[model samples]
Target: MPTSASVRPALNHLQQLDGIRFIAVGMVLFDHWMVGRIELPLGALGVTIFFVLSGFLITRILLSSKDKLSNQPNGGIGKYLKTFYIRRTLRIFPIYYLTLFILYLVNEPPVRRTIGWLALYATNLYMARHVSWMGTVDHLWSLAVEEQVYLFFPLLLFFVPRRWVPLTAGLMIIGSVALRYVLYQARMPWFIGYVTMPACLDSFGLGAIMAFWWLYERERFGNVFSRTRWLWISIALFIIVTTLTKVLPAIPDSRGWAGHHNIMSDVWERLAASFIGFFLIGRAVIGFKGPMKWILENPVSQYMGRISYGLYLFHNFVFNVFHTQPTHFTVRAWRRLSEMMPFLNSSYFFQFSFYLALTVALATISWFLIEKPVNNLKDRFSY
Candidate 1:
């Protein structure tokens, strides 16, 4: 393994990481569009990838900020916190709140009933409490989890001693797994185990651990991640564990055992998926090669990754569920198109393509008109 310090530079933008983001959002879109048509947990896998990626990126940013401010005076810490919160707000809050506002204007019933929780970024908690999804806005649970994590994770990183950060993250990982097992044994709703902030900590913790290794243990990171075998091992572990959840007989009151209802699905499947995400992210950070590099770094993938947040935000709404009134114009238009051109309704692929195209279009529009312009404000709050 190369022990060169040059491998880890100041974290700037990585296009390959965006490609990974594209893959993550693609999984989510496909899973939601083809809900009962597929047996795999592509949505969970995608969300885990997102959580790990968020943890890695945010931890890197925090650590880098800590390093920069270490030499400064008393106000350095304040500046660090201010800059981080401001940038995060600029990136996350604008579109999110705007979406809520629009939904409120349209009198969307789910939003009307849960606006309080949604506004506070506690949609995950609301779902856990209610034990029911809030329709199309159900996907917002992961966003809520990420927002909640952002609220405190920076403080944890900032206050903890540098040497202990990795240890702290490891404890978080273990705690999350333990929490899920406890919840499963208690027979709490499956979404509680899946969506609650504490139960989802493992994915974030794994990402944080990888970030720390890359920053402080470069040679070790390279030694492990540079080899292709670890990646394959992670894939095998994910597949094996996920497959077991599918193939195993369900326990009584297991909610059919596929969607995080069983102990294996609730507890182990996510951890397995997190490992895959951890290796995938670590590998992306180091670099990719050959066909994999091309796949991840191409212009289309990069652009998709750049707009992935919008893609994820708008995709579920684009999918018209049977017997549900279509509120989104794209969904309504698609319904009209299906009726006018009956052939479009003949195959699942046609519907999938329509939804994908509309989602991409909406995401593209949001990227240019809303996200990009607001994101430019982040430059004013740079760390």
Candidate 2:
């Protein structure tokens, strides 16, 4: 909540850290493509990666500030909630609304239909209804999952002790994994994925734990993470291997290491993915730089990260705008993109390009009109 001419994160929000956001969005783009056409069969795991990073990063921030936050009278729950929501609003609402506003003006019937759910943060439910319309603005489910967790998390901390954070996070992981296992067994559609929060809670919980380690457990982890590089290498290996091959498909698509496609296996993979996310994020923040950082934190890429919410919310609608055509090229034309962009060869590449371009346009427009202005509203909560 502290705002100044040079507002900084409690633990140096590194120059390239923003790049992970791009990674998450990119994975989503590819995953959607894979779902549309099963050429690669190894795409949606990007989202799992995203969830992992989310858990790690959010945890880092909270744990670092735990002491100061704890010292506050009554755990400072009131101020913390106010500031948190204010920042979230600045970050999430503006661009989201603008896209809806524009769509409403155009009377884009399909997008307009989903607006009600988005307004209520019931996007997961809406996506539930349109399970097959993966191209619809269904990705918003993750955002809903994250925000819904944020809504209750601080209260949890206020009521619970700092020492219990890790234990709580671990429980969340168990719950999330179990939930996901059940869903997998039921053969549920991906659209309602976030509804299975028990399977996802560990990601956020892991993040909270990381925040604790970075802050209070600094001494224990300082020499460990601040100096570790092998951790980063291993995670990078996992990211690449999982993306290119089916090394980690047990959770993303399959069931487990034993090749048994059961709920138990799915649970195991979910936990594994969460652990990987925790390490990757902690390693990066502590100075584990790699080749991807260069492009990940680039000015444009960072901006995309910033306006990513808008892009995620609107890209599907932008994509579906051209659904009138049964032809792939016709869909591309609706977005004003030329399918002849020589680089788009494979299903992954083609889907990546289309989703990328659509997100970029959405980001650019949303940043200038909605995101930036909405951020200004933070001045109101500066108290």
Q: How much does candidate 1 score in TM-score? A: 0.94
RMSD, model 1, all Cα superposed?
3.1
Give per-residue CA lDDT, model 1, range 188-209, as digits (tens). 7677888899999999999898
- The C-alpha TM-scores of every prediction are 0.94, 0.75
Clashing pairs in 1: none
lDDT of 2 at 381: 61
Which has the greatest TM-score?
Answer: 1
The list of candidate 1 runs beyond 4 A from truth reads 1-8, 254-260, 320-323, 326-331
For all candidates in order, the CA lDDT equals 0.85, 0.60
The clash count of every prediction, one per candidate, is 0, 12
lDDT of 1 at 112: 91
How would you encode candidate 2's per-residue C-alpha lDDT over 110-144 as one tens digit per residue? 56776787676766656556554423555666766
